[model samples]
Target: MRPFLFLGTRAEDLAADGEYDAVLRFSGLAERDLRRVRLERDELPPLDLDDWSGIVLGGGPYNVSDPDDLKSPAQRRAEARLADLAEQVVDADFPFLGACYGIGTLGRLRGGAVDRTFAEPIGAVTVTLTDAGRTDPLTADLPGSFDVFLGHKEAVSALPGGAVLLATAPSCPVQAFRIGTRVYATQFHPELDVDALCTRIEVYRHHGYFEPAAAEAVKAAARTATVTEPTRLLARFVELFARR
Candidate 1:
């Protein structure tokens, strides 16, 4: 199988490897079968859907619904590129899994409203799979409710007509959704665990997920945060999509 294309920004350190590590941790892709393209730092090459098994988009700081003026040229380009790729993915019902920010990018393409009104902060929260989620191919076996790490400032306010609402939480109505047979999105960090979330809480403290001084508390919360079996279903996602 061809290498799965891992698209997203470059995390200076912990994320330096970007979704590569996440994919490794959660998917069937080995280091050799995964190739990462940091859209923030590199000019994305033309895409050929046949070149890989599937596409996996990681989370980022950019919010798609934000004003155009607020988006950097790099972000704009990245979104456009991803949007173009999304159309192809949707057209073929290609295998795809988008985490966190991936929801906004694909959600926007599917005519869903992406906004900050329902944005959730960094930490762990119980995500209840909707009836649709309970029946979804990806989430069918997941518990009705489970704790998963999350850190987003935007959510799907209105789902596109054909999209299935896979998961929801009191904090954010659209925790996860699916556009087609193989395309999926989530507001939670399926790639993250307690130890990983604490790292992000510390890095993003001053950046705003919580009060600057509350980093410790947030870290504590993350430490005790529960990681559900469903979250690791993302690995199964990789096994199906990335290793095809």
Candidate 2:
């Protein structure tokens, strides 16, 4: 079977590694089946969709909506590269799943309004599947409403044009959406668990997702939350898209 590709843009080693591990674990993909590229350190290489089963973009500190002056050179380069890649992925209608930052990339491509208006704090939140979500292959089998971990400074303020709204939350209306049959994005972090969320909360404490002083409290809340449903999306993606 062709391996899946994991693209991440985190600059911090701990957070980056944790994100990869979580995706690997949840997707039930062996290390050899999941090839990871840290976009923070390398440019997105020329991709041939035939070489892989699918692509997964993980969460990161980079916000596509950030002002140009505030973005790092690496962020700028990665964004430009991803912008080009987004076109290809959409044109091919390739299988891709993006969590957190992934929503921005796909959302922007479809002319969705990505902004800070729907930012969610670090914690678990209830996500209700839309009628479309309940019928879509990726999310169809899941409960109508379930808890998921999410913490982002920006989210899709308006639904992307021609994109199906899959999930919605009171804090963020555009919790998840799909473009074409094979492309997906979520405002929440599907790969996170208690430990992963705590690690991110600590690593990004100063990055302003929340009050730095409340980091421990935030972690404590995550520790007690029951979040076990979202990972199914990853497993289902692999199940539905893996090729022989």
Candidate 3:
């Protein structure tokens, strides 16, 4: 079976590795089934879509809404590469799932309005499925309304043209959406479980998701919150796309 590719940009090794592990854990994929490429550490390798079952983009600290002048050289380079790859992925309606930071990539490509308008605080939020979401193969099996872990500095304020809204939270309207039958993106971290969330809380405590002093509080909250439902999305994606 062809492995799925996971693209990530976390500069912190611990956070980066943890994100990949969480994805593999939830997707029910073995190390051989899921390969990773760290965008921050190196250039995006030349990709042949047919060589992999699908692609998954993980979350990161960079915000697509940030001004060009403010972006680091690495951020600029990563965005350029992602934009190019996203064009091909979306055009083909390839099996792709982007969590958190993905909404920005696919959102912008489809002409969605992305900004800081819907910044959600660090914690869990109730995500509701839209009518389309209720029927989408990837999300239909999830509860009509379930708790998801999320914390974003910016979000897609408007749904992209031709995109279908899959899931939404009161604070973040575009919790999840699909560009076509196969391309998908979510504003929340479906890869995150309780332990994974805590790991990030510590690694990114000073990265501004929350007050550094509130690190313990944020972690405590994550430990107490029940955030299990979102992981199903990962499993469903793998089930639908894994090539034999």
Taken over the whole model, the C-alpha lDDT of each candidate is 0.78, 0.92, 0.91
Off by over 4 Å in 2: none
TM-scores, each model vs. reference: 0.93, 0.98, 0.98
Q: What's every prediction's RMSD, in angstroms?
A: 1.7, 0.8, 0.9
Query: Could you give candidate 1's per-residue lDDT for residues 82-125 as a string of tens digits?
Result: 88888888888887888887788788865678888897778778
Put the candidates in lDDT order, highest first: 2, 3, 1
Q: Is candidate 1 or candidate 2 better by TM-score?
A: 2
Error of 3 at 82 (Å): 0.5
- Tally clashes: model 2: 0
Model 2 error, position 8 (Å): 0.5
Which residue ranges in model 1 land beyond 4 Å of their true spot?
A: 242-244
lDDT of 2 by residue, 1-244 (tens): 9999999999999999999999999999998999999998997789999999999999899998899999999999999988888889889999999999898888887667888898888999999999999999999999999999999888898777799999998889999999999999999999998888999999999999898999999998898899989999999999999998
What is the per-residue lDDT of model 3 for residues 1-244, given as tens digits with 9 covering 90 to 100?
9999999999999999999998999899999889898998789877999999999999999899999999999999999999999899988889999999898888887567889999998899999999999999999999999999989999999888899999987787899999989999999999988888888889998988888999999888878888879998999999999986
Instruction: Report clash pairs, candidate 3.
Output: none
The window of 10 residues in a row where model 3 has the poorest summed lDDT is 103-112
**In model 2, where is the ten-residue run with the lowest total lDDT?**
103-112
Q: How far is candidate 2 from the true structure (C-alpha RMSD, Å)?
A: 0.8
TM-score of 2: 0.98
